[model samples]
Target: MWAAGNVSDVLAAVPQSAGAGNTAGGAINMDLILEDARRATEAREAASATPFDGTMEAEVSRRVLGTRAHGLEGPA
Candidate 1:
């Protein structure tokens, strides 16, 4: 038991069995961490973007363009 209660000790306490590994195994791998972060961000962005977003943008563009092509129009 460490009286200092260092961060390394706390990290080491975690089991590798979990998805996140502890520093007890070895040095931290920045590449893996960055890759994991990138994957998480991509997944989050994909989940946040609903299917209707694309359709809504396309519909608005079409209406605006259609109105512009017409002789006169106040609202699309």
Candidate 2:
């Protein structure tokens, strides 16, 4: 099935009716959700200004080489 369909199935299977007063405690809090979305958008925009290439690869290389590259090593 499609990804959306799978997500819908997973959401539907959650125990929405098992909480106190049959209310779904796991339901989305729109205010908190909106705040999170706003923060994520801001973070993405900030990150777009200073993009790094091969960041993960560089980290792995630092570990393997046992050298302090890209500030990955412990403080002096």
Candidate 3:
């Protein structure tokens, strides 16, 4: 558990509990990131997709920037 208040109260608290919890959370987050990357790679390969060529990338960027400038872009 996490707590914030008076300094003495905080000092008396068990800091290791938060440390252990955060360590567990970090591990879980890393596993999730790895799994997501694996899935994304699988999807890209299945699509027979290649990385965007420079011209195509530039066109997409132009359109996106134009839309944003015109306030036509949807919520991020």
lDDT digits (tens) for residues 1-76 of candidate 1: 2122244345543353332333323334565688899998888778866647887767877777775544465474
Give the number of colliding residue pairs in candidate 2.
0
lDDT of 3 by residue, 1-76 (tens): 3333333254434675566556667877898999999999999878753668687666777777864644567556
lDDT of the structure predicted as candidate 1: 0.56
Please tell me which predicted candidate would have the highest TM-score against the true structure. 3
The better-scoring model by lDDT among 2 and 3 is: 3
lDDT assessment of candidate 2: 0.54
lDDT, candidate 2, 19-73, per-residue tens: 3213323234555688899998889778834345587666667777665655477
Looking at model 1, residue 67 earns an lDDT score of: 58
Q: After TM-score superposition, what is the CA distance of residue 14 in candidate 3 from its true location, in Å?
A: 3.0
Let me know the TM-score candidate 3 reaches against the reference structure. Answer: 0.50
TM-score, ranked from best to worst = 3, 2, 1
> Over 4 Å off in model 2, which ranges?
1-28, 48-52, 60-76
Two-way lDDT contest, 1 vs 2, winner: 1
